[model samples]
Target: MGSLSASYFERAQEVIPGGVNSPVRAFKSVGGSPLFIQSAKGAYLKDVDGKEYIDLIGSWGPMLFGQAHPSIENAVRDALSKGFSFGAPSYNEVLIAEKIVSMIPSIEKVRLVNSGTEATMAAIRLARAYTKRDKIIKFEGCYHGHGDSFLIAAGSGVATLGTPDSPGVTVSTAKDTLTAVYNDLSSLRNLFEANPTDISAVILEPVVGNMGLVIPEPGFIEGIQQLCKTYGSLLIFDEVMTGFRLSSSGYQGLTNIQPDLTTLGKIIGGGLPVGAYGGKAEIMNMIAPAGPVYQAGTLSGNPLATSAGLAMLNLISEHPEVYDALNQKGKALAEGIRQQLSELQIDGFVNQIGSMFTLFFTNKAVKNFSDAKTSDTAKFGIYFREMLNQGVYLPPSQFESWFLSAALDEAHIDHILKASRIALEKTLMA
Candidate 1:
């Protein structure tokens, strides 16, 4: 959008494939080169060429307190003064773990990792070792990072690229991962029945974010819990996206379901790269010096990440209003967009839960990946570009959820609504 961004992208393309470290950031799906960000403060990001846009993606759901929050910055600074990773344990890691355990009832003992992928990979290994099984069941479109076992039918970048399954994934790896439909209890039931007695874990996004904010139907998550219990398989809620974004306790709090193991990332790090997995003490005990199942990372408990995480968790725990505020902002945005769409005579369905939502250009309810695919992607793509031009940032792909931040205010919502109104007008004309 700016001269600096344009020049940077042009130069980057010569070296970086698609000029982006992450595929979605290439803007292939949305059309246009990505905006090169310079810095962020509060609710806006200033691009390299000094163009400011109200950030709605919130760094893919990590900026819960908003970007560059002084407290978190101070925490990171203080931790840096102490030194970075020691390739060993740190007290801040324990403090962050205790904070997580204190906030989320399901996490009994957590093992810190560098990213959501590591957390998921470890959780699966622990599950496999705990159950002595070889297969895992995950819902289609519920992305649990790019782990080989999770790439069977992931959303996010894989969905953006129009590849449901990656090419390099071996049949052996694919065989170990079974897929089921989200929000469809019958599909999961069928999968369980078809493959009897070999599932190590049943993992899913309790509030599906990857396939554009597909909320679970009532009793859907509860049914999965029941099935896992019956099959003696661990029910692992991949809370990587929904963790602190949805509620203080995550989907478990909203759905009232306690998973055997929960994978967390995003907000836990306060915009840093960090992830964690924990569950019933009995199962977690099997993952280390206590048991044979081994999972290790050099930066497993990096002090910087943990310090930022501690600051974030401490603020969220003390102020439950953070969740309430985010819910209010999300509701406002969803309802405002709904009204605008109706006014524009656009056939759209907006699926939302707390701060995560998607505007599907279809009349059909998007409760699963199949339903989401039926949306008018071309139309949404146009709308996305229009919104971006109007200085309202959104997720570049039709299938990615818009991550709302607690930093959004009424004025920001009004601005976004105005932008949507204009964008919808342009989209309808096109």
Candidate 2:
């Protein structure tokens, strides 16, 4: 007899490609059939087989307060009473827009979209329209959604599958998207020097969550900003994962390096499908009805998304101490994992900041895509399976970041650590 999740996946494979909507969800990197979740609440996920696991993914970085957070749930419920998508202007849309502007300092004017992909695509178009340049530069490990221009040298699922450049993206599109080595200013400078006037923007994840939580070296972000300025290119910070998770104003709030445009998703929608791009008023004015660059969505500001997002933003604003608590929790978890690795004599490296973390099965300090590639993925697969069996869920791929939610109490952390210890031992045996 097999698990219900396995049965469901078999059934789904006949209909859904790879038996999962997302590639990574298939657990290809971890080498197992993915768990079909029945429901989630707080820090726990109940799978279709009735096995509950302590969730570390947090819906891939949106569940800051955890799954089914009362505030966000109530907000969505209230929105349901009114209606779903309106296809026209609504009060909640305006409210959420105002809330975003107030929270993120760099965004002077914002336009809402359906997903991070739409936000980034529109942002790139806006940058091209404003700067009158055809090319853009992106860091190697930075995953900026599934836009055709971004598929080249992308991370996340693309990296996990070992396909940096996806099919269907034209040769011309790939050429226009210049790839730069993350944390290497000289590499970026060379690109700028080569491209010169052709580059329109430089988009990157200020604190990359894809390619497993790689941090920016000191002055690296500042150097990128300076290069963008020097080359007359707009700077775009893809904060789909980092927004609100790292801080109220995103990573820019922590670094004080303001970009010309910022793309945001995940937490802003409070687990709903929503995204936005905003920056200087002048550049934003060029979008659609405001100007020439065209971008529109019928469900751009879906009532439920706006309501939930507004509630989430309000909650964060009211409880600023959440950041401190989250940092402490993240530190504790990372430190605990480090201790386990030392005790077990496992060659591993844990990169953690705020509530985002990833324990690479390699001794190399992961600062960029190349370093991240050094990870022992086969060993990680063993560890992932062991952790799942121990009732602690993690990201299915080694190249993805694990998000910790505020819902996880100290007891949950202890459980996770205990499970991790057993998992590590099992991995060694395997």
State TM-scores per candidate: 0.98, 0.99
lDDT of 1 by residue, 302-331 (tens): 889888888988778777888778888888
Clashing pairs in 1: none
- Ten-residue region with minimum lDDT total, candidate 1: 317-326
As a whole number from 0 to 100, the lDDT of residue 328 in candidate 2 is 96
Per-residue lDDT of candidate 2, residues 52-106 (tens digit):
9999999999999999999999999988998877788999888999999998989
Model 2, residue pairs in steric clash: none
lDDT of each: 0.88, 0.93
Stretches of candidate 2 above 4 Å error?
A: none
Best of the candidates, lDDT: 2
TM-score of 1: 0.98
**Residue 2 CA displacement from its true place in model 2, Å:** 1.5
